[model samples]
Target: MSIDSQKGAGLPAQGTPPVVPPSAPHSAVEKQVARSYNSAVANETLEDYSLRYAPKSFRRWSEYTVATTALGGIAYLADFAIGASIAISHGFENALASVLVAALVIFLTGIPISYYSARYNIDMDLLTRAAGFGYLGSTLTSIVYASFTFIFFALEGSIMAQAFHLGFGLPLWIGYAVASLIVIPIVIFGMTAMAKLQVWTQPVWLTLMFAPFVFVAIKDPHSYAAFTHWSGGTDVKGGSTFSAVGFGAGMGVALSLIAQIGEQVDYLRFMPDKTAANAKKWWTAVLAAGPGWVVLGAFKQIGGAFLAFLIVASAGTVVADEPIEQFRHGLGVYITAGTLGVAVFFVVLSQIKINVVNAYSGSLSWSNFFSRLLHYHPGRVVWIFFNIGIALTLMEANVFSFLNTVLGFYSNVAIAWIGAIVADLVINKPLGLSPSIVEFKRAHLYNFNPVGFVSMLIGSAVSIVAFEWGFGHGTFGTYAQAFSPFIALALAFVLSPVFAVLTKGKYYIAREDTLPEPLTVDGQLSGVSMECGVCTDHFERPDMAYCPFHSSAICSLCCSLDKACHDMCKKGGASSGPVDLTLTRASS
Candidate 1:
């Protein structure tokens, strides 16, 4: 909790050249190799504090605005498609049970994560780093979270492309390009542009999304009654009866979206600090925009199921799950004159709203992943193109063709990763087994923490085995394949605490915080700013850590990029002796 002034004894004064130690090579130690980011990365407006803590100084939006913007990003049609697909495979009875179960699980798990990210002002990557996965250890979860963004991005883009094909007579290839390219201009500006875009279009999107359903109720009242008895297709076993295996299969596909909370927290990180005066509004906003997203998402899935049931006989089951097709037939029930145009417009808007968020969150995760590995960061804007390009490639390859298979297989890994993090945040921290406060800086965290990282690995490995080969090959295999996601979640949750106790929580923090300034003031992250000795840029207090090697305060970005330091400040490098790796109880 106190600064180690003795470590800077032999170190030269700030802004002065230090005496080169004879024990090390002189060439590499002569100059401070600090990282310099471009204007896009340096400025909070363009970068939105990507790859670092979202300081209080930059989190200026009101709770209502932040909540709306976060919820706006969830305006995707994929839920409808996912719901329709699950129903098609598992019949109405099983699909209904599965969807509700998945939604409940997602909502409960999302609560702790959302609260932490909003309170701490850090993205999912930083949260993971401190929540059991260490600095380098979080790199694994970063890739897992990044994959979620792009896979969904491609799926949403493919849906948008279908709209283009339906309305403009564009070929699927050209439509794919259009869908991928449209979000670039908007996403280039980061949260500033995205907030405006989402807020302005939300009303219109909502109107179009629900208009068809309202009209169908008035025009075809009997359709709703008939849909209740729709026992999937002839392919489904046992007609409309529910089956345990079928429910589990549906849950696996629905649970693939466990990582969607990462996207929610990507925005939740910007939530203004909650004060007593705004406590009511703060909790409401966080819950609604965070876990509350699944409420609407579940409804959309059911709505998609209803719409697909209406048009399956006419359009065939193959295209029933496509969002563009679902909306086309739904809107056609009332707006006969320009149904295609309206449906295409709605699809394009929904895709753009959600894809920008997908692209934005992807850039953040990729930035975190590459920064730790390469020790270099050009800018966050650069990664937007990289994320979109990958999604575009997937679209070109027609990734939408194998949606169920891809999502089902992916759910195992996603659930395991998220489950481990949730266990750390909810169980380990509260039980005084791990650090209560999220310590995300590279200076304090170990390279790897077995508590969450190994638990996630074990959970993912076992669940993937269950999903692919299924325990053995008989009835066990069938049940295992159907319930692999549940297995992954349970193992990760149980193992996180077990590993924390086994490791004695020593791996959680490499060294105690040595910054001179307090991390917070009056129960809130301090707005006091400090200048980075290496980067020569001013950053907020939470982002700055004392660097014994440089004999000055350094920003986290500069600390992360300083290759020559070798973390001497924490490890007792050239100037300081190795610090004790003791387990300390962090403040609640």
Candidate 2:
């Protein structure tokens, strides 16, 4: 055929649909290979991106706009309660010093994590998996991260319950249940609606939070002077003598917020793609919404400490750590008739803002957890209710009464998890011990990797032992008592490189999966859609892998959930019998 005739024949006829070959990257073979699996096809919504990547197309919001919405969640007044409680238990100097140290560590660690998540568009779970912890190894962090969410959820819920009791004479039990359940609908829509909720309430929450502080400062400057010298008299250390032991204990509680970086990056993952044109805007948003949470958090903690002292000065009592009581008494000094009303409104608003973020993040954590452990996929929405149920139970168990002990204990594990991750990213990757880029697909990773998993395990065990003083009665016990978090972080950081060297970084990549046929279009964004054969749904290019078991392309979620494949797509993976997913759900 002549060249002109070939060109005319190659093009689709006028007004006729173009023919897409089944062998092409975006073939029309999506729903043809395997049986329909579960409700994953039905669950797609504004839940942003759960158990999947946030593609370029889904990232429609500007960097600054998303940052503003994400930053607003930090207005949770639990910082007020936690700051007051620690300052009362351990002196002002110890608590303040501890807060500064913890904030510094959290900010430094958050930077690499935030950059990777925004640049690659993955959540903490996927980041952990690709960093050094293997596919199943990262599930341990998933459970730990999930626990952080619910623990904070329960703590924030208790604050809201107290607000309810003070405002409406509601019973504490009923208030706890109400506070726990009210966030379900708000978070069900995920970032889209949740972002709006936080943005709209930011103005009201900021006004109310600062109003009492400004009012108190202007009305009675003497209270500030009184606040400086008020030492919470304790049986240990004899009233704020700046003991090393006190600083360590206080720091243990403060460092629990380190894991909160996970929740922040969940939103940052949806940030619009950074380009040469918007590079400055992107970095500003990442820092402000990422590590900047703690900058504001540290300030609020100091504010809370001062507020507690003001309550002590005015009310002649040092027991004002409870948020409802602190706000009630602080506002009472200036407002005449409706002080309780104003205090209750601010407290409730603050709790709602933080709890929504907590609940939403918890749901994501739970989804990662169950999806891995059970090998049966349920929608993220189902896990939202499960997470709330656990938090509600924790609230009823009275987590607030023992907040210091709980957070101090949790801080050890939280920091250890973060330390291992940070060490892997900063130390191992650049040293040529591990892969340079993140490979998160299940087909590309081992079931578990010892580099991160073993490091976190040993770190947690050593820290917990020190927390309980497993060291014999000697200089070691004294050191352990004052350096628990420091000990855990140092151990994890040091051990990660050692483990990486020992393992030779062999477990980082399972298979290269060099496909015979391309899984992506030649010239398009990674968001170009490819259909999953099993689920009968389209997913972004990165999320779709060519499945040898099904002999077609399938989404990564379906691949991860496929027990029948038994990782047969990878080397030495033999095919197994298919799992009855419905029966698995029923038995559970």
Candidate 3:
């Protein structure tokens, strides 16, 4: 046998997995689970990188490439529709105020979250595991993030369907499937395919995206007057003037995209290793791609409002908010031949670009979610089909018509989730209530951490109750509905710090990060290559974990699926222990 063959053939992958004694025999079930993990990784390429940290080698894309690709995901026309919906319901003053406030909040929260995810080379799900959620705790976040994707996917797909219906004379049902199915092939290759598509189509998309608005702005001044004065005839509801209540409600709808930062980080993680020489380029790309998405989204929404107003007389309130209809009318001023056809082309192009991202991010989210719950492994490709299927169903059910209602409810929970994360990163860790470094490995974390999980649960529940049931009678109930998300955000921010102080950061870290030298060629460990002792498979270090049951390093998927060994490695199994300052924090 070769020297490499003998390297880890019989010996354990070595840091003596803290689990059962080294001499304990491996169970048949343990062996089976390990084999399954190896298979899962082998089949999951389109995910770009999943289940663990993206390695340096895989970080081959330039900063510009990753940033632009992430930005491309924001090219969806839903923002336009959302903007139009709010303006028509709330009037110009409230809608404008809503967009600015929501954009500011989303941007602020995005800064730290984006920087850390990119610096650590982890996606939001993995980052959540360390930030505060802990092992099984992040499962809730995974589901919430997944819901955002499919909901947005369905909304975007609906827009595409409408375009097809108007242009090609296709049925909405077939258009829904067509819009949903076309994205599958693009996303199956993960970031690799997504980057190419976004970059190639960007110039054309930008020209088409901005051209209609510029033309309308240049040629039609009366449209602006109508937008400022119109309120979709909601005068009795106080829609003609600025209402604090209306602004808050509209803001809730816009902030629902706070979860979109997760999709951005998914691509930013692939940004090439930051070097001193490229420092300027690195930070620029990270900032632009990360939370910077809403900057573009906010303006596009304003444009959507303007265009919707331009067509409200002809299209009416029911159809005015549709991007297909808005753009068709906007383009009518400029084009004489195939006017509807040209408008449909731009709308279809926009939806395809954005839905691919929705589909891709949803797959990543579901992969993280089910892997933690089932302990059984299926590749991410399976989840892509699963994610798209859910969105397609929503499209068939006509989810787009109830846009504001769906998004308003969803934003409250999403705000809570994002708020807790931000609090942990900005406040808790800085105040010395928690560990500064993020410890994501399962063996090194508790199953739940109240700093984020408990806070999130309470915040989401309170906001939901307020959003649905009246907080008080008459005027107060209106305030409660509009300000629902602020309640979630404020409570999460306060509760996270409170929980950290109460718990004394005891649940933050389990055991220290101790990697086996045998699995790494160098003294230090990395995500490059490490051999799993049970399957004796060469796997990435990010996928490998120190397991005492087998007295070796096992891949995460195997460790999750293993039915035995029972987490004995961390001194107290299942139950968490306080952090030991003596153990020393790991440096990134």
Which candidate number has the best lDDT?
1
Q: Which prediction has the highest TM-score against the true structure?
A: 1
lDDT of each: 0.84, 0.77, 0.80
- Writing each residue's lDDT as its tens digit, candidate 1 over 40-92 gives 88777878888778987678889988999999999999999999988877778
Reference-based TM-score, model 3? 0.90
Better of 1 and 3 by TM-score: 1
- Candidate 2 Cα errors over 4 Å, as ranges: 1-41, 233-240, 313-319, 513-525, 572-588
Candidate 2 C-alpha lDDT tens digits along 1-588? 211122222111232222222343323343345556445435556345688888766777888768977887787877887788778877677878888998999999999899888877889999999877899999999999999999999999998998899799999999999998888888888888878888788888888888778888878878666555545643222345576777888888889999999999988988887778888999999999999999989988878877877665444333477778888877877888899989998888888898888888888888887778787656777788888899999999999889888998888898999999999889987786776666678866788888899999999889998987747578779779567887889999899989888888877766554432222233222555666667666667667666656656667788778776566555542222322333211110
Question: Would you estimate the TM-scores of all the predictions?
Answer: 0.92, 0.88, 0.90
Candidate 3 on 251-299: residue-level lDDT in tens? Answer: 9999998999999998887877666788899999999999899999999
Candidate 2, residue 104: lDDT:
96
Ranking by TM-score: 1, 3, 2
Clashing pairs in 3: 17-547, 17-548, 18-569, 19-569
